[model samples]
Target: MNEEPRLSAQDMIERLEPALSPMTRIRAVAALLAGLAGAVFVGTLWWSEPGPLPGRTQLAFAVFTVFCLAWAGYGGWLLTRRAALFATDRVIAAWIGLVASLTTTGIVTAVAVRRGTGTGPALAVGGLFVAVALVLTVRAHARRAALLRRVRELTGPEE
Candidate 1:
């Protein structure tokens, strides 16, 4: 007679997902959306401007756009691969990302506000990044909580 396993593979995987990469699929999606949107929005504004832009401003735009694209590419790659990042690591990463998004948005929007061009687009792009960052932060916290809960469940209640 064959004995049934205690837990189904799918159920176990679901329970353990928060421990592995801290929900890689969700994090990947967050990164992909933020990076891809930021790159497209910024790059379009950078190129579509009719007025002559300052050399330094152009360089900054190019560098920023390239970095966003690189982030997007990394997210896409993560979807197919596995990288271990603990819950605390995910939280730290999310906060750093949020700060980066805020800073970049502030600087770029200030530039456009002062120049009186592309201000609206700058805000829109920045808003998108900020929103994604917030989502990432919340998700990271949730993942951490879930992982802690799993640990508690596995180890049983405190004495």
Candidate 2:
């Protein structure tokens, strides 16, 4: 006897939606702004100060920042395309978003620590942002997994 049942579109939406409230989106946006600001601060220091290996370090940092931005943009594109495609598995996209957030957090943390700018506050804020972003990512993954499970349940056993 087949055990899996077929899932409908509505059922899929119900399973996949995390119901991310408006407040959460706002918080994420705020965090992103703060990260951008931190990047600017770091850039100022990197350019203003003269130290050993300054050119190499600054170049490396610039490249890393650009790469991270590109990664973030790519993640956005993937998400948009996935939405247009009505794709059910969002695990990869969600993880991409998560990685972008983590990367931003890392950049901010590095800048704050390297500059010796009394990092307690920056670290705290960045950490909070990272934590929330991670939580959001996990929720998204859970929703995707739930939908896949529901779909498999509806499909039943195959010969």
Candidate 3:
């Protein structure tokens, strides 16, 4: 009797390539474009400002922009990986939550240090962002847990 040899990793990937839906490709491209657009928009805003920002404000703005760009790019890139769909979605959601939380914290800290009438509105807006971030983080964790259970079922019991 003749038997077929096991497919290598590369062969398996090649076999699976055509099975990927066009929607996945579209989503990846859309994400990549959005990431690029967001980075450009932030850079343009900074460049078009009339005067130089103070050192501390400049540092804060730079940190916020860096985190935003990093997460946007990472989210786009992660979609292209061959990992489980739910897992990738969870990761992207978590990144978004992290970026939002960090940005809100930085803005709130800056406002508190400045300490003026405007601080009230700034804090209010920051608080709203924090609430949204908390929700997203919680949802992502729940989705990840569900995905973990699905993965375990597919793989069966382990020793």
Candidate 4:
């Protein structure tokens, strides 16, 4: 039977260096840190509050804290398991982040509007978050395209 040679550890590391870019690492770390901190902060406040609160308010706090925890878990998994994100993976992750941001923004803005207070500020802040996520998503797509182009160039005209 014919056999393909395996890449040595050093060779693998060399190839992986590109996939593990600084920007990718930064994004992963930022997500992990932000999510974790938010979760902890919210949970602490929810636990340490004095006096009774409305049932709905308590539920909201719990739900928000859980959502933050979910984000932290996702970020942790990505940092450890998907540290060396390929071009395709990077694009997918970026899109997921964008969607998550947009969804959160929409929910927050809607809640503020429904409460009949702080609607303007909520909308503005949410819009800014969506804009940032969109920019990141676009950059991820562009980077993936450029990397694919480079790979095709290296692999000759067959592609």
Candidate 5:
């Protein structure tokens, strides 16, 4: 079977740079959605809590709020930075950051479900965030690896 030759990292970057503008726009929309979701979460908590939340649940909410903000910031960075070249290394770093963020969200949600009172709808929303985060992380890692391989091919073995 015939196989296509791989393009070099630089070549790939050259091709992708043109697409970055649209990608940046997409990232901005995602950021706005994430911020909206955070607002909804806060609203739900306030609405649902007929009584005061325990100290731990309060703390979880605080932490999750910050996490959501950070996600927004990341999206903002992607939007503003058209100079953004997804170096293979940067992709790996992004994946790591995203995983850490998602893990924290998962743990907090688990604790809230077990110890704090939560609504079914809220829990489902949290679960959706986790799933989306996982999918994004996987895609980022795959892109990074592909870039790295392309970089290797471009440089080749030194004589």
Candidate 6:
């Protein structure tokens, strides 16, 4: 009986390169679009009437916007790198966590400021955000871990 030769990790990766390349590019483009959308949203907020937002609240919003832009830009940059496909699963998980945390912060800040309420509501909302972030981060980490395990199994033990 004749059998096909087993491929080395490098050979397997080479064979898969064509398929992976497009995925990386798509991720990069998505990141860029998200960043652009976030920037536009911030711009719209600036163009709108200031309403009753205090200077401190405005500053907070500006800081949050900058953080959003930075992370999205980082994601795009990371996905465009030559080693993008080789990035560790942990790195991707961390990026997801950062994005979630930033989004939660922005939403909670906006709600708190818009309502102009006492500390009670703000604290409640902040707690909820923290809980949600924790859940998302955990889920992302678990998923990445599973993917890594499957890849490892396919590729054999790491060098």
lDDT of candidates 1 onward, in order: 0.77, 0.58, 0.67, 0.73, 0.64, 0.65
What are the candidates' C-alpha RMSDs?
7.4, 8.4, 3.8, 4.8, 8.7, 5.9
- Clash pairs detected, candidate 1: none
The TM-scores of all predictions, comma-separated, are 0.48, 0.50, 0.70, 0.62, 0.53, 0.56
Q: Against the true structure, whose lDDT is highest?
A: 1
lDDT tens readout by residue for model 6, 56-159: 66775676677557657765665655532544533564555556565656666666677785456656766776677677667767776776677788777765
In model 3, the worst 10-residue window by lDDT is: 11-20
lDDT digits (tens) for residues 1-159 of candidate 5: 999988765566666675466655775668757866875787578558878887876766666666666666666666555443655334643564566556666765677677667646555776677677677777777887787677678678744
Q: Candidate 3: which stretches are off by over 4 Å?
A: 5-27, 48-52, 112-115
Ordered by lDDT, highest first, the candidates read 1, 4, 3, 6, 5, 2
lDDT at residue 153 of model 6 (Cα atoms): 82
Q: Flag regions of model 5 displaced more than 4 Å.
A: 1-19, 36-52, 87-136, 155-159
TM-score, prediction 5? 0.53
Model 2 misplaced stretches (Cα beyond 4 Å): 1-90
Return whichever of 1 and 4 wins on TM-score: 4
lDDT of 1: 0.77
- Residue 56 C-alpha lDDT in model 5: 72
Highest TM-score scorer: 3
Q: What is the lDDT of residue 27 in candidate 4?
A: 71
lDDT score, candidate 4: 0.73
C-alpha positional error of residue 53 in candidate 6 after TM-score superposition, expressed in Å: 10
